[model samples]
Target: MSNLTRTQEKELKEAFDIFDRDHSGSISARELKAVFKNLEISASDQDIKNAMKQMDINNDGEISFSEFSRVMEAQFYRKYTHEEIRAAFDHFDKDKSGYISADELRMTLSKMGKTFRKDEVDKMIKSIDKDGDGRISINEFMDLLN
Candidate 1:
């Protein structure tokens, strides 16, 4: 925690906030489970209970932000495999339109406040790729993710 830069801390806070659904300053198993569901993780209840047991850190049945941050930090050094990065990209892809170029990536992320269907995303990506004349490489996307 002491070695984390301010930006890293902010990123961790943002991630924790996503799981703290009730604004309770802590994350519960239900909240964690809901987020996992959204992320398309097929974790079982027992798996979640084990995760809670590992993350809560205080045996309190909930993960405080501090606990969450510590666990995230502990896991941060691992490099994402291609499959892992692709899975993360797929999670945000929403419409299954596949990857787009950098310009479309920025545009699509900017419009995240609105929902886009498969056809819409496909249309947008096709138009952008037609103009840009190239697609985004997985390595490039992985760099963006990093």
Candidate 2:
């Protein structure tokens, strides 16, 4: 009953395989960023820096594929339930319009204690605004969640 299909799980494993460049079982900061870039996902420079700091459990500035996989799997598992996903979308739909608008995104992020400049939020919205819509549909929101 998990939301993750077998193909999706396999793809995740494949991604982990490709990102483990050195075969040392560890992905360096550069490696993780490379994967993100390849996926066409842009994080703010500070976001990447913060992620590296937190995800590199040993403070070594490097994350093992096992470590990365563990985090990803935990996140994936947590949202395996349909209700969990629906609840998350509900949280993102700030206006209660059943969709996520830029203001909604900004407000939700701000409520989470993230301080993003208006322009920065705009830039982020531009990047994730799939389908050229000004707002994110539930499907788009789910994609971003992943």
Candidate 3:
């Protein structure tokens, strides 16, 4: 099972609640269709049914919190293509240094309007910096994403 951080879990729960209309504590097919419609994604009845079947771990024809969290968590950590990883790495390496320093990460997050403390940024860098080089190389970033 995927272990989600508290923040992630909260976000996922919020999303699930948005989709679970009627205060049913579960996502019905009609509610799922409404969600797709709100997202402007075209989904047929069969498509919705198939998705419900895949996410309804207990085969109950609906998605409970546990099932919704599991499916959403898997989607959250889905692998990225090499090109996507390279593009992200390029965006983070503002100095063109081929490696992302903790300061760069902080600045990037700031630009995106997401703030983190120095220790949090350091922890993030440490998690992705496989070489313990105090920075994130392209390879290290790719490995972390994949």
Candidate 4:
């Protein structure tokens, strides 16, 4: 495997620090909850449970820093590319009006045959709609992507 970039490495280290509250080389559910809370992203109890299930590869109810970093790196790599990161605002700017609307986003993903429950979509939209405008602009979309 390739080494992480300096920025990614630093981010992983900081995340580890936050998630590793006890400095015991592992993260418990409480630490995970703190991380999510600190980011101001509201995670449902089920979401936290599911995350614990997925991140705790050994079924130990806790995640080692290395495991946590690996899971995060895998997910981050799947969603981002050098070129996409460089031109994301332009690439996902489907409206061509220099913005991304919720409708545009839903339509684009729908065209790809993806599926999401109405509640799921609503939750995601709510998170990204920082202005409460019922629409997502390019800047907002970029923030969500990051």
Q: Would you list the C-alpha lDDT of every candidate in the order shown? A: 0.71, 0.70, 0.85, 0.70
Give each model's clash number.
0, 0, 0, 0
TM-score of every candidate = 0.70, 0.46, 0.54, 0.50
Q: On residues 34-75, what C-alpha lDDT tens digit does candidate 1 reach at each position?
A: 877765678999999999998988899999999998889865
Candidate 2's residue-wise lDDT over 4-52, tens digit each?
6787678566666667655677777776676666544577778788878
Candidate 2: where are CA atoms >4 Å away? 1-73, 76-79
lDDT of 4 by residue, 32-52 (tens): 887666545589888989999
- Residue-level lDDT tens digits of model 3 in 1-146: 65888888997887787787677999999999976775455899999999999999998888999999877898668888999899888878989999999999998766543568999999999988888989999999888778
- Residue 104, model 1, lDDT: 52
* Better by lDDT, candidate 3 or 1: 3
TM-score of 4: 0.50
